[model samples]
Target chain A: MPGYRSEHIVSSYEEELTQIAQHISRMGGLAEQAVASAVQALLKLDHDLAKQVVAGDKALDALHRGLDEMAVSIIARRQPMASDLRMIVTSIHIASDLERVGDMAKQVARRALQIEGLSLNPRFYNGVKHLSDLILRQLKGALDAYATRNAAEAIAICNGDDEVDALHTSLFRELLTYMMEDPRTISQCTNLLFCAKSLERVGDHATNIAEAAYYLETGKQLSGDVEELQRVQHKI
Target chain B: MPGYRSEHIVSSYEEELTQIAQHISRMGGLAEQAVASAVQALLKLDHDLAKQVVAGDKALDALHRGLDEMAVSIIARRQPMASDLRMIVTSIHIASDLERVGDMAKQVARRALQIEGLSLNPRFYNGVKHLSDLILRQLKGALDAYATRNAAEAIAICNGDDEVDALHTSLFRELLTYMMEDPRTISQCTNLLFCAKSLERVGDHATNIAEAAYYLETGKQLSGDVEELQRVQHKI
Candidate 1:
């Protein structure tokens, strides 16, 4: 009878972990949607879409809170060791990162709301469009890495941030030049700069998730040292 | 003798928690120093101080790693419950916020390094200086809330972020107007804008710490609603 009860407890523990993962996936979906919708809203100057993206942040935050509570319950009830413990802890960390991603999307959506009625050249939106797309791809990969326990994918996403940072800097300069050329466009361009900065932060948060994902899957930290990371990335 | 041994273990556990608090204090001091030094470096264009601020980030990061390890060990060994569990979890989160504060300071310092030798009008740096100073005060209040377990201070720190955001936006406009006045200052003005943005983020991270600190002290999440938050502030 005792053996039967122990096995049942084990199965239920596994079930709880599954539920935690499902919560993460749901949050991930919302985060991805928020970023994509926010970017589209920005590029298209669609106020309705921007409002939807802003409103959608609440759902993501709710998912985060749910996942966090689930994590703490699992940790307390199961007192899981080693990787199980890491999984629960890492889930909490990753949920916070995803929540922040949604917040960044909200910031961009707010900017989209502000930058209405601006019919600038198609060229002005091109860099931001590309950067937003890059960030989306990075975010998706990081989430996939977390879900699938793919250390290689996580490391690649981490290394991929350099490109994101570079693009952000280039866009910063490009926006600066535009503002200098046409003082009239300064307000609009400044909004774009803030949008670009938020997107840059999204990439940074993705890097953070990828690193934590790597540790969750492999139970090892990504190196902070540039040379060490370079070698690891080279190998990967 | 067995009872004595059991009591000894309990005392040792309490001592370990004390050590954790000390680690947090050290981190708080480093975070405050990093922000102060980075801001001074930015305002004065002091390259040496900027480099020092950047370099000091590594130490803060090292402390974060140490705290994380300690937290994991405590959780695994003690299987802490209720407030005890929250203290460990909250410590981990606070360490992260402090680390990010250091990261934002490093961002400002890098901007300072980039803007070397451009002796502009004193007014150009004034707004940035004020913003940095305000952010530093916010960060200090948040850390103090954590260290002292003061829920009221935590609430105040969270509410104070509006002023920080308002100042940042104003500075954003101020810098834009300056750039518009003189195209030659666009690059430097852009740098200032980025610095202002970084300081603004420091305020954000500090607010995050304060919210988490509040939960650690009172076992309650700050209300996300403006009305509820206003009610709580009025009570405080």
Candidate 2:
């Protein structure tokens, strides 16, 4: 065990990069679980399940602290620069986005309890599920890119944000129709809207992760014009 | 002007660090202005001003790009290690928090439009304004700590977060009463609740900057058992 501990210590510069990447992968796993729990809670309207998802938030928060600690330790011990520095800084940002993703999931679970008895359009549920899946995939892809330091994969994931945004807009319009059709559906529809917004926000966090990955690989920005993109696609 | 360009070309490692610091300071200044403008629009109920603030989100978004560029450039050129690496990574997180601070200000402005005619309990407004001031001071103090490498100031700023949390709880309870007092206030009251939540979040971000500063100075987490503290405070 003593020998194992010493071997685990990074003796060379390259090993330090490997260590940071490992921590980021662990963080990704925690984020994936948080998102899964959030969707599960929404689908079943299960209060117990929702609370379990909320409880997972503590773990996710802990993940950020651990990642940050590992990062600071790496910087102190390794004296990394250039791409290595980018990786550490990017990990820090991605950790924050993941934590926020956990928060958004909790918000969805809160809405689930309020909308338990209320009817939701099957179409709306399906759209949200699809959006959640897309966000999950995007996050997975971004992490993969970070692990491999693959700029191409990172850019691909960044582009995937558009599809998520489109789904969110369509979901918004469909829900608005439901609210307008029946005033009695107002509260439930409103709650659902917030849930959809939460999912959309998860997509945004994924996009942020992707951007970080891209920067880590290239040390340059991708697009650098989120506003222009927004203007062009006003639906965002 | 020619002399300045010559100096730039001949700039030493320390000069680059100073240059990055100055740029971050400028970004922080812009972020501060954005928050002030957002709050001004809210207090004055100026929709046009609010719209302007919303539009200016692009500029804040652009600042993220600028900060990343500066950080990467510094890392590439200086190859800073240990405490200096912590400083650079800390700047990256601070930039992100300031960007979110800008977004929260925009959210406050949006809430103002929805609650145009409603009279908020003056106490609630005062509570929020007080919290906002505390966050502003915290941000300022955190930056000062970063500049001076002062761990004590950073710790003091972190302690101030508790005051903001207490105020948030009081505001939440007061808003709940307003919602219960009359259903008519529900919609507008909810908007105000979001505004208050946003301000509370700003305090949280400021606290994060302080923690980063502490890490830079001490090379160890000054605060004890983050997970335990998170549980006790229910920060998650």
Predicted model with the maximum lDDT: 1
Write one digit per residue (lDDT tens) for candidate 1, span A1-236: 99999999999999999998888888888998999999999998999999999998999988887786787777887898877888888888889899999999999999999996876667668988889999999999999999999988988899899999999988988888887888888878888888999999999999988998888877777855456478776784
TM for every model, in the order presented, reads: 0.95, 0.75
Candidate 2: misplaced stretches above 4 Å?
Answer: A1-15, A42-55, A58-63, A69-88, A106-130, A145-156, A159-197, A217-219, A225-236, B1-11, B110-124, B169-190, B222-236
Write down the DockQ of candidate 1: 0.66
Model 1 chain B worst lDDT run, 10 consecutive residues: B219-228
**Candidate 2 global lDDT:** 0.76
Model 1 local distance difference test score:
0.87
Report residue A95 deviation for candidate 1 (angstroms): 0.9
In the predicted model 2, the residue pairs found to clash are none
